[model samples]
Target: MIRLQSLTYAYRKGAPVIDGLTVDLPSDRRLAILGAQQSGKTTLVQLLAGLITPSSGSIERLARLSFPAGYQRGFRMASTLGQNITFAAKIYGADADEVIGFVADVTGLGAMVDRPLRDLSVQDRMNTSFALTYALPFDTYLFDNTFTVGEPDFRAKCLAMFEARSRTSGMIVATKFARTASQFCDCALVLIKGQATYYDNVAQGVAAYEQSLPVAQPKPAAEAPTGA
Candidate 1:
């Protein structure tokens, strides 16, 4: 279980992106965080991952958490996909060969596993990244719109991977896609204007979100001004 009390953080003084946010995350469940851009979703994840300390709150966790972001093949674009996965496994102190084989099977990278990251498609890159993270034995996983970076079929597989992980561990995913949240998450947290509201069900959260959108004004039918 993870507990937060009076969590507040900001890049600058007197202005907090996450303002006094306090909530509890149940063990072994999937939670979807819904928010517009710049709504502190990533910041919240960072805090949870211990990458950043909250300015004025307490966070207590009973398990290890892992976050997979900032993953890409740039300068070392020549490294094979399998090599990248193996590197991550080694960092986590797992058996490299077993990890590679397991992730390759789970991600369906198969033959492409030995290919360089630069040679892989966008979908393949995402698969490799997820497989690398999932192969580690982290108690909690935080994903920030990472699963949506691939093709539909591959994205489905990524979602399945997350579901499998949630069976034994906790997961908190931040995404703008309501459909993704509705399909995968058991609970939802809607963040609006720096405030976080928890929902017991995803459907209710989605409905509330849809209702909060500004109604589109109907275009007036084109008409000649009456003889004015």
Candidate 2:
């Protein structure tokens, strides 16, 4: 379980991005964080992962969470994909061989695993990174709007991988779409403005989110030409 107390964050001389909020996140199931653009979803995820410090208040994390999966920022473009995996596994104390093997098999990197990251195409690199994300052990996995990346087949495979992980680990996925939330999550956390509401059922939360979205207004037809 994670406890968030009076959480607040703000940039310098700016309005609060996350205002006085408190919630308990129990790591027992999948949770979808639903939000519109700039709704603080990414900020909240980073705070929970201990990647960023909240400007005020506190967070108590009692479980280990993987960094945003397929996060390629930490990878060195000059090194081989396998080299990167070996280094990360050492950092997390996971078996390097197992992770490397998994990445090779899932991404079809095979011998390319021994090649430099600079040599792989962007698509291959992305696939490899995603495979490596699932190769580690964590109590819960974290994601930040990464569900639609790559080709359709790759996206489908990644979703399947997430489902497979769900059987043993927890996941917190942040997305802007209610459909995406309802598709993969049992519960939902909706972030509107700076406030949040946690719904036990995905349907309820999706309804709340849909209600918040602005309805598109049809354009008025051009006025008919006035008779001279």
Candidate 3:
């Protein structure tokens, strides 16, 4: 459980991305954050994961929440793949060997784990980033549109792993896609213009988000013969 009180964030004194948000994030089930672009979905997820400090207000986390899966901010480009995994495992209190084994197996890196992260191919980097996601365990896992990683086959593997883990771990997914939310989440949190509204029903939350979209202006009925 995470309690947020008057949470707010702004970019360089610009309008707040997240404004005065105060609510308890559910950890017993999956909660999908539904919002259009620039609606603070990612910002809220970051705050929950403690990746970024809020400009104002406070966040209190009661459960151990993992960083957003596929987040590469922790990667050390200069370090070897094995060394990076070892460092991350130590930081997250996971087993380095286990993490290393998982990544190497999935990426076919084997002994190549000794290679620097910068030397790895794009596919290798993608595989390792996701492989490391499940290498550690947390009370709650956070995701911000990180479902697909690496090649299609590797993505399938990641999905399989996530499905197994979902049975026990809490999940919070931030996405603008309705299909993603309906497929994986039970409840939804809708964000609009920096404000948040929680919905017990995912469909209802999606409806609210869609309703907030700017409606296209209908073409003025071809001004039929105005003042002749």
Q: Model 3: per-residue lDDT, tens digit, 1-228? A: 788899999989599999999988888678899988878888888989888899999999888898888888889899999999999999999889988998888777887788899998877887788778877888888889766687778889888878877899888999998888889998899998889998988888888888988899988677567685
- Estimate, for each residue in 107-213, the C-alpha lDDT of model 2 and write its tens digit: 77888877889999988888887888888998888889874358887778888889899899888999998888888899988999999998989899999999999
Q: Please report, in order, the local distance difference test score of every candidate based on alpha carbons.
A: 0.76, 0.87, 0.86
TM-score of the candidate numbered 3? 0.91
Residue lDDT tens for model 1, 1-228: 788899999896457889998888754677888887888888888888787899998899877787644345321568887777777777677898888888688667778877777897765676667766777888878888655446677567666777687888888888777887888788888877777888878899887766766699999989977875
Clashing residue pairs for model 3: none
Which regions in candidate 1 have their CA more than 4 angstroms from the true location?
Answer: 69-83, 106-123, 146-148, 223-228
Query: Which has the greatest lDDT?
Result: 2
Per-prediction TM-score to the true structure, in the order listed: 0.78, 0.93, 0.91
- In model 1, residue pairs whose N, Cα or C atoms come closer than 3 Å (at least 3 residues apart or on different chains), thus clashing, are none
lDDT of 3: 0.86
* Top of the candidates by TM-score: 2
RMSD of 1: 3.5
